[model samples]
Target: MSEKLTLHKYQSDITGLMIEHKAFGVFAEPGTGKTPTSLYVVNHFRQKTLVIAPIRIAYSVWPPETKKWSDFNNIKTGLLHGLDKEQRFLDDSIGIYIINPEGLVWLESMVAKHKRFPFTNLIVDESAKFKSPSSKRFKALKRVIGLFKRRYILAGNPMPNSYMDLWAQIFLLDRGERLGRTISAYRNRFFTRGGFRGYEYFLRPGAEEEIKDLIKDICIFIKATDHLDLPKLVINDIRFDLPKGLRKKYRVMEKQLFWDLDEGKILASSAAVANSKCQQIAQGFLFESLSDKQKYDKVTKKVYDLHNIKIELLEELVDELNGSPLLVGYWFRPDYDKLKKAFPKAVYFADSSKSEAVQIEKDWNAGKIPLLIGNIASISHGLNLQKAGNHVCFYTMVWNYDMYDQFIKRVLRQGNDNDRVFVHRIIANKTMEEAMIMSMQDKSAMSSGFLNAINLYREKIKEYDE
Candidate 1:
C-alpha cells in the first residue's frame, strides 16, 4: 500500500477546502503552518501555480520549506524577478513560478499587450498588499488576474483599517460575486456618513453582520489556537513604565493636545521640552536648533540611552541561552540606527541587487551574526531566518500586520530547538504602541470575512461532492 499521508487537523481542513472554493482565504494566526497549508492547496490543484510574494520570501521561503516534506524533488519551480524577460520566460515554462508584487510595475504593461501566459493559478500570497484600491500594484494584479484560470488569495491580515481591503482581493477571485456590482455599492450599503474636512464622510455602521453575509461563500477561515493537538503557542504582553520625569512631560503634552485641544498652545507651552523628548525617543542624544529651513532640526550627539535599555533586555535573554543569536525586528530609521550602531556586524541592509541581503541571510543561517537586526521592508515576508534565531524581539510595533506577522513567522517555523517561540514587544507605556497592537488584532479579522464567503464555497463544494 502507498504510504499514508499525514496532516494536522487544520491542514486537512484546508486541503478539503481546496476542493470547494476556487478562491480561498486562510486566516490562521502566525506560526500555525500557513506556509505548508498554502502549498498543499497548490499541490492538490496540480496546476501551473504562480505565487506572488515579497522578493525576499520569493527567493528563500519555498525552496527549503518544500524540501522538508515529501521527496517531491522532481517538482519544478521558477522565480520571476528583475527586469529580465528572457529569464522570466525560461523560468515560467517550468514548475511553480514565484514573483514579487513590486515587479508587477514592470510586467503590467507587457502582460496587457501580450495577454498570454501559461499559469493555471495565480496565488496572491500576502494579499494585504493589494488591499489599497489606489495602489499601482492593485491595478497591475487585476489586469493579470484575467490571464489565470484559477485565483487564490492567501493572507493572515487582510483587513488593515476598514472593509475597503475586502474589495481588491475578492475582485481577483470572482468579481461581482461578492460585495455588489461595484465597490461603491458595498461601501454605501454597510457605511453611514461620519466626518470629513468641514464636510461629511462615510463610515462602517454596525456592519459586521452585513460584511459577513456578503462574502459568506468564498472564504475559509481558521485559527491555530482553536484547533486541537497543536503545539502550545504562548503569547505574552510586556509593558514598560516610563520614568517619572518623562511621564510628567508626557502628561502635559497629552493634556494640551487631547484634553485642552490647543495645538498651538501646546507647542508654545513646551517648545524646548517637546524637542528634547522627541530626540531622546528617537534614540539620538540631545536636540539642537539649526538655522535650516526645515522645521525639525536633527539630533547633534549620539544618545546611547535607548540602545542601552534595548541591549540590556536582549542580553538578559541571550545570556540565558548562552549567547544564542537573537533576531531583532526593527522598522523605524531610529530603531535600525540604534540596532546597527549597537551591534555593527549584525545589521542587514537591502541593496539594489539585494546581494547583501542574500549574504547576510547565509551568515545568519550559519550562526555568524548571532545578533541580527532587520527591517520589515528589507526582510519581512519572504526570507527564512529560523535556523539562526528562534527568539524574536520587537523594538516597536508597525501599522501593517502582514509585515509584522510574516517577520515573526520566519523565526517560529518548523525544525528548531525552541521550546516555545519567544516574541517580546518592548512597547513604551501609554503610546501609539498600545493602540497599534489593538488595531492589529482587529485588522487581522479580514480572514473572518471568509465566514461570509461560505455561500460561494458551498456552491463549489456541492459540485465537487457530486
Candidate 2:
C-alpha cells in the first residue's frame, strides 16, 4: 500500500482558494502535485465530478492517482473512455468520471438522452485545449456547462499560443463574466487586427493588465520554482557543422527551395516547405518526396542520408554519462529512425500499445531502460518520468516553446532525485535549427503573463494580511 500523501503549503493554500471561489483556474506548474490538489477539492465537495483531459491523461493519470494517495480512497474514479466507456458510465458507484475533450460531444448526447447531467462539478485538465471558441468540444461543453455548480480549469501554461487563446478558457470558468460573452466582444475591446491580411490580432496597450485584473480574483497561479526545491536545470547547446557537401546542399535548398539527390530531385514548393526540408537535412537525412498524402509506416521511404554529425555527438554524450539513463527527444520521423538505429536498445515511447506503454513507463522509472526515446508532443504533458534519470538530449529542437518546455520538465520536475538536470540540445551550426531555438526563447518570454498574475495576487494577499 502507498503511504499517506501530504500536501505542500502551496497546495493546501490553493485548495482553500479553490473551495472558496468554487469556480477557479489552477495554473500551477507540472509536477507540483496539481492532480492530488484537485482531487482534494473533489473530496471536499463530495459531489459527482466530470474531468476532461488529454486522452492519455484521462485514462492513465486520474484513476491511478486516487489509489496512490490514502486520503483519496473515498474518491471512486472511473475512466469514461474506449469501447467500455458506456458501460463504465452505468456504474453509479463512481464519484468521478474522466473523459477526453473530444468525448464531450458524446457526453452531451448522453446527457440529453438521459434528460439529466450526472455531474455537478467539472474539471478541465490541460484546459488550454479548449482555447478555440469554435472547437466542437468547447461548443458542446458550453451548451451543458450551466448544469455544473462548480467548475475549474487547469494548465501549466494556459496561453500557449497567444493572449487570443485566453478568452474561451476563462469563459468556461466564469461564463463570460470576466472576459466577455463572445470572443468577438473580447477581441474588439482589447485587440486590433494585424499581421498578414489582417488575420492576426495584437493586444492594445495595457490590455494585458486589464485582462489579468479581471480574472485575478478567481485564478490561482503557482510556479514550481517558487514552491518546490527542484533539481538545477542546466541547458547545453552542443553545436556542430555539417559536412562540406551536406552544407552546400542545405544552402541550395534554403536559397532555391530545390536540391538534387542521387535517388531523385527534392523540390520544396514554398519557403515553409524549404524550411522544413532544411531542418530534416540538418538532422542528417532528407525525404525524397514531400507528399502530405504519404504516411510514415514500417516500410522506409526513399530518404537520402546526409550526415551523422548529431548521432556521433550523441554517442559521445552517452559514453560520457557512463550508463546513466538518457531520455532523447526527437521531432521528425527520420530523427527517431536514426536514433533507434544508432542505439538499438533504445525504447520508443509512442510505438507501444497502451498496456505496453504502461509497462514501458514502469521499466523506465525502475531504471531498466538505458536510453528512452519519445516525440516531444507525445510525452510532454501529465506523464511523469522524473524517477528515471536527470539527462535529456534533443536530437532535433522543437519550434513550439510549450512542447520543448514540457518535455524538459518530464525529468526536471519535483520527484527528480538528481541534484542537477542536464538538457542537451544538438544543434547543426548555422542552420534553421539555430533559428528555431531562438524562436522558442522568444515565445518563452511571452508566456510570463501567468506568472505576472501570480505576483499580483500574492501582493494583494499580503496587503489583506497587513
* Cα lDDT listed for each candidate: 0.61, 0.81
When summed lDDT is taken over every stretch of 10 residues in candidate 1, the lowest stretch is 445-454
Candidate 2's C-alpha runs over 4 A off are 255-274, 290-302, 443-466
For all predicted structures, in order, the TM-scores are 0.75, 0.88
Error of 2 at 115 (Å): 3.3
> In candidate 1, what are the lDDT values of residues 1-466, reduced to their tens digit?
2222367877887767766777766655555666677777777777888788877667666654566567334456777775665366555446677778887876665555666466888888878778776788887777667778777777766765456677777787777577665667767776665322222223465677776776767776665456633234455555665566655554454334333212333322223233334324423222334454374465343334432465555556556767677777776565666566666665555322455666777777788876766776566665566676666777656655566776777676554556677777766555434544664565442323222232233333343221
Model 1 spans > 4 angstroms off: 1-6, 66-71, 83-85, 90-92, 112-115, 195-206, 228-248, 259-308, 311-321, 347-369, 376-378, 385-390, 399-406, 413-417, 427-466
lDDT of 2 by residue, 13-33 (tens): 999998998799999888888
Report residue 99 deviation for candidate 2 (angstroms): 0.5
Q: For residue 243, what is the lDDT in candidate 1?
A: 61
